[model samples]
Target chain A: MHKKLFIPGPVDVKEDVLQKMATAMIGHRTKDASKLQRDISEKMMKLFYTENQVLLSTSSGSGLMEAAVRSCTNKRAAVFAVGAFGKRWYDMAIANNVPADLFEVEWGTPTLPEQVEEVLKTGKYDVVTVTHNETSTGIMNPVGEIGEVVKKYPEVIFCVDTVSSAAGAKIEVDKWGIDVCITSTQKALALPPGLAICTISQKAYEAAKKVENRGYYLDLVKLYDYIQKKDHQYPSTPSLSHMFALDYQLDKILAEGLDNRFKRHEEMANYVREWANKHFEVLPEEKYASNTLTNIKNTKDISVKELNERLAMRGYTISNGYGKLKDKTFRIAHMGETTLPEIKELLSNIEDILGL
Target chain B: MHKKLFIPGPVDVKEDVLQKMATAMIGHRTKDASKLQRDISEKMMKLFYTENQVLLSTSSGSGLMEAAVRSCTNKRAAVFAVGAFGKRWYDMAIANNVPADLFEVEWGTPTLPEQVEEVLKTGKYDVVTVTHNETSTGIMNPVGEIGEVVKKYPEVIFCVDTVSSAAGAKIEVDKWGIDVCITSTQKALALPPGLAICTISQKAYEAAKKVENRGYYLDLVKLYDYIQKKDHQYPSTPSLSHMFALDYQLDKILAEGLDNRFKRHEEMANYVREWANKHFEVLPEEKYASNTLTNIKNTKDISVKELNERLAMRGYTISNGYGKLKDKTFRIAHMGETTLPEIKELLSNIEDILGL
Candidate 1:
């Protein structure tokens, strides 16, 4: 039906981005391929607002998040959770047998600075992971404030998952002392899935060297060294098609201006939030609501599945509440290449479906 | 110019295969996505000639190779190397801090069955890795003989990398007693870069249970467990576009018949070898020559770079020898969807350009 996607990720990719993926295959070790990879890495660093080395992976954003925690947590890790995604970091830690503890907030609440300070002062952890944006609850953590507290723990590596927020929000990665900032292509980058990119600091690299059993594939130190030696080519082959599309999309983002892109996301987010508040309660606190997506409490108790079914019939689709919030709250993603006009049309379709 | 790719990997992708990657994105957790993933896995098992579980990764074949070594090597590993890719397995072990030792044969020599017997007699290693085809040396090891020897040592986990030969040659993975068989899309699978598929056996899963620090993402144990739990969906997000293309291509391969595909590859290999032997020395022993590619030693000591340049002008591209062998030999790949007619054309072009 050619439905427009307004989900948290794997959003509706632009035609230009799609075309870029159809680019002819090129030798991975060729100078041309090296140039393309190097260019993308530099552009990604700019997007991350950091001078740290940028590393690319072919797996989802969670892949790099796991890599950061597994590689950089030489001693122990403190994982702070606001929602399902945050808790996943701890799960990753336990499953990989990495020593870690979790400080979890309620689903709708953000990870506060005070909480981070309490953990950091204990001197129990060599690394800490926090999600900048939680799509499950439409909550964005107070990373700037948390960053200040994290800075006091100089020996600890600060890893941030900006999977759903990076391009849509103002995240000063360097200022935040974020040793590893992870993101994927499917979210605010406005591209198809399958590629994860990160900026790795020297702190993270050094920490990785101390960690034994840092498995291959996502071995941060090995990847860093091979990339430097091989002119930006990975030890493992990467998704070249995704790189082609990402290079093109990043240029588009730059053309639109980073601040302008963030502002567009904010404008669309504000519109959606105001609309949701007029009809129902916002799921997250006003100050902590995510700029990329908004969760609306089903105060009126409408069937979100039914609403989305109707929206899909009209060639548009939105996401229902995730995990525990299903049916009790619904979400509308406003990030990526999605603009205010598109958000307005989506809301208008919902209004018509509900006869509001 | 649209040049024909005759390299070991990043092989020529068909236009329809490239188009499949342009398909619309879908939510990874949705029913439709699950169906796509499940269908691809089922088809992959057929291609691998195994009834075992097939796991897919967004990264290249190297990712799964690393996963196998990391997950299955709980005690110690004996890595057999004939060339670059085989040495890579040992490198992965060292990077992951796996207790392992490498058994290296000369670059063009195959790892023999007697060697496997000697290694297994020690009872010192619980896992072994053998590259079925060494693309760098144009040698295909006698894995079936090694498999028989490995079967005698029931406790040892056998991992085989068929990255360049799986679909193009006959590999009865289940009958061969291979615990983990890995291959990527770019080689004989006749697709674009990205996407690695592997089959894991029950024995390997048991071995994985005892292995710790099997980091996330490529953790074969976690992937196997999660896919079983989630009905074939990966624990992390995957490349849906690659899945689409692979699913479609697998159908094409089946329609062509596996025996016929292997025969065609053999015929192409023979034709190339005959041509290379007529004009130059064959790099590998004839008994161990790869069925997918042929390495021609530069007996004339001509400029391989200049030869490739002239060939490029004629709309074709082949690879020079890798690492230490560069300029001493050249490679021509004839696997994947590359047909005998195309092979004839490429060989003719080289003959004309080099004035053979």
Candidate 2:
């Protein structure tokens, strides 16, 4: 039996969206391919609330995260890590030989604006990276306030990993002064995993131009230039299937209205948090908690594995805690098209299974 | 209204195989994902005829092509370029700041074994890249013979871009002493674009270990280690949809028998070549011709654009020459599930359209 995915990503894609993946292939270099990408880029601009040039990659969000650090950081990078995904950017910087420093807070904490200001004032970093929503921690960083601090540092490029929060939350890329905002099809987009998208500001592109050795496949400068040169085409053969599904899904997202989508996510998230606090306890502070997924503290210390196994029998799946948090805290994602009533149903089922 | 893709990639996939792309989502962290990847890897090992570890990337063949050069090359690389794809590896090397030199042969010419031997004998290169088949030129290099030369140079890591050739042609990766052999789903594999698969030998991994700063995402060593540590799970989320389709398609490929599939490709290629030779003349030498696609010299100076427009009306499409060869030659691909009769039918349509 196919379990309904309430996990962080690879969320249960709708039937129509899944069928778009089965559309017949088209040549990536053709005019039709260009049109498909152009359409996606325009819709993505709406999702990001930016006029920044958007780039698509046939990769996970990690791909563009690596690209952002390797391409824009000329001197050093300040990676503010509230959780695992934030530290991954730091890891990418180090792996690519891009000098970087990681300022990590407690797992459930969010990277505050003052913390970013303190790091930026050091002048050791020309590029700053922050995870808008840390999937591992369920803490949403205050990027808007952080961007106000970043705006003071004219030399520093503010890059955000909105991988798990995009479309589910209101991320004002232009208003936030986010030079690069990275995301993927999975997570809140409610599509299957494959394509990674990022909004690239002209400032980020300029910074990237100064930084040599950006590496092929992930070079933002080249990617930006190539699209202009080739009429909205990527450097490599992108996943046309993903583009088809993404374009179709984007239309559905627009139809529902962005405000309605965000409100739905917020409502579901608040419900999950309230239930968690009533039955157990929420992991992250309620004020800083993510609107997409809730990381619940296991105050009952129940066997998450056993619960998941039982949930599988019920044809549903939620995530066990990530990394060190395993069994200590479990995660229930409410993003994508997951409705509040559906969230309540899963919680009720969990209560029945555990006798909470 | 879908034109049968006869271009280099994004080939027309079978309806059932395409439907596999719509397979319901599974968490990348799940045991089920591991099984899917593990099954695909084993089947891929069989496809490449290698015992080397297989790594899958949610990217185009170019993504892995960039990875191979970036990860394993510590010393200068000798890139042998027969066509555009070959030059791309050199471009990748340069983009990543890897010291490399390009040895470019004339377009439509194959990278000869002796040429590789000469470069290796110089002792200036510890890594050498060769395109197994130049898709632009429709010329398949004698990689088996080049492998014999490569085996003599123990210090040199032999990397082959079999992006357009792997399943459609015989590639004994072990026998060829290839450190890395890369291919994507869209070409001869007859799946939609997105995933890139490559085999990494122990030598290549050891070389990667010696090499400093292999960037993340495309980092082969990290990818190798993560799968080993996490029970075949990738460090990043992979395209589960592609994996689902690829696994199903591999079974279909195997069911048809590898030899039978290759023979079918060869027969179709032969028929296209024969038809082209009688009318317009094959672009590459008949001996060095590709067993997947045939590039025909436009000696008659007929309009390829017009020919394709007519062919598109009949639910068929072919490629004009790539890059500089545009207008001078036109190509008809016979790879994937394209049959001998289909090739004849396409040729008959061309004859009728052009009054050949």
Candidate 3:
């Protein structure tokens, strides 16, 4: 089926991005390969709103998220969970055997500054994790406010999962004092899956050095060391194809203007939220709603499976509520290269199918 | 500035392979993504000489090797090291906190069947790892003979790293009792770096079930379970761009014929070895020399780095010996999609530069 993805991630990719991926291979150790990586990192630094170095990995964003927690959390980690992705941080911590404490909020609720402040007051952790746009609940956490709370505890490494929020929303890594800010290509970046990019502060690097057994491949210190030594290249072989596509896509993103791109996402989210408010309920509070995607409460007692079936027949597909919220809500992602017209079209089709 | 790599890995990639990587991006969750992955895996099965399931990971071969060891080693791992990469298996195990023992052989020496038998006879391990081709020393282990030794312990999972030898060497995965055969693109496969492929048996999957804390991203059991559920797709977003190139490149490889490719590699290795022996000395014994690359002894007391610098001036790059052998020896990688004509030209250039 030639269905367009309206899901939270692995969203519809542009043909140009795909074409960039198919570019001929090059020697990874060659100047051409370094040029490709260097270009991607420089552009990625701009996208992440950081002047710090950008590191690329071939794994999904979660890998780096895991790397961040494992690498930087020498004492303990205070992981705040607003939704599924936040929970994933705790899971990643436990799986890597990193000592961490989980702070869970209700599914549709966002992580608040006060909650983070309360946790930071404890001073028991050297690292903290926050998920910036939780795809499962469509809650965009108040990371900017939380950043204020975290900055007071400079010893604590602030790691943000900007996987779904980065390109759709603003995340000024340096400005917000986030030590490690991670994002993946498959999300709002609108590139293919499999590659992740992050910016690590000097503080994060220091914290990583203290941690032991931070396994190879995802070893943050080793990666940072290699980049410093090799002039922006990764220690291991990188996904050159993805780097090519990313370099091209960043130009498109920047040409659209970063603020303009953020606004487009907001515009799409607003359109979907308004439409859902009239027909059903928006899952997250209007004050905490995500700019990248909207979660619609199934107030009309509608079957999402049936709605999706109808949507699929029309050559479009959105996602159901994730994990515990599967039937109670559904999600519509408006991130990445998706345009205003595409969003309107998907909404109209959903409305027609739902008879709203 | 137009330097060609002959460094065992990150080999000189063909223009077509690079071109394929420039393919347009597609949604990873879409049918297109599934098709690409399925196609790559099916083609990879042919490359590994197995009907077993092929899993694609957006990591270097080391990542998958770590995954295999971490996931499959429930009791203990008996890692046999012929060179650096073989020692890497033990490193991964120790780093992951997995119980493992190393059976070391001298550098540039092939792992013997008797050494494997001695270790397995202890019955202290449920997993064993061996590197088919050790890039650091140019030793190709006797995997077939070692396979017979491992077969005695049916409960023990056999993992092989063919990072530098996969496509250039014939590895009958099932026939050789290899529960996990790991390989990456950039080497014998002659694609760009970034992606690694592995063939996994049911036993390996079952073994991973008992091992806790396999870690996210490289969790082999999770990967296997997710693929079974998602039509060969990964739990994490994969590197679709690499797959696009890999699919196209695999077709080219198959078109050239696997046996013919192996023969070409052997001929190149023999040619390089003979030339190096006549000029200086062959590092490994004739019986143990790699079919993928040749390590040359620095009998002339020549500076390997200086020789490489001289070669670089002529637009070619060969590797100096790694680790302790850094200045004592040098290496010429004959693997990847390198043709005999290209190898002959590279050798002739070396001769011209060295005036030997």
Clashing pairs in 2: none
Alpha-carbon runs more than 4 Å astray in model 2:
none
* Candidate 3 Cα misplacement greater than 4 A, ranges: A30-39, A300-315, A351-356, B1-4, B14-19, B30-36, B299-315
lDDT of 3 by residue, B1-356 (tens): 66777888777778777767655445566667788888988899898888778888888888899899988988999999988888888988987888999999889788899988988998898998999999889899889999999999989999999988998989999899899999998888888778898999998898889888888888888888878898777867777767887899899999999999999999998899889889988888999899998999898888777888888888888888878888889999998877789888988987777777
lDDT per residue, candidate 2, B90-136, as tens digits?
Answer: 99999988999999999988889989899899889999999998988
Best by lDDT: 2
Clashing pairs in 1: none
Docking class of 2: high
Off by more than 4 A, model 1: none
Candidate 1 DockQ, CA atoms: 0.67
TM-score of chain A of each: 0.99, 0.99, 0.98
Instruction: Name the candidate that leads on DockQ.
Output: 2
Kindly report the interface RMSD of candidate 1, rounded to 1 decimal: 1.5
Kindly report the docking quality category of candidate 1: medium
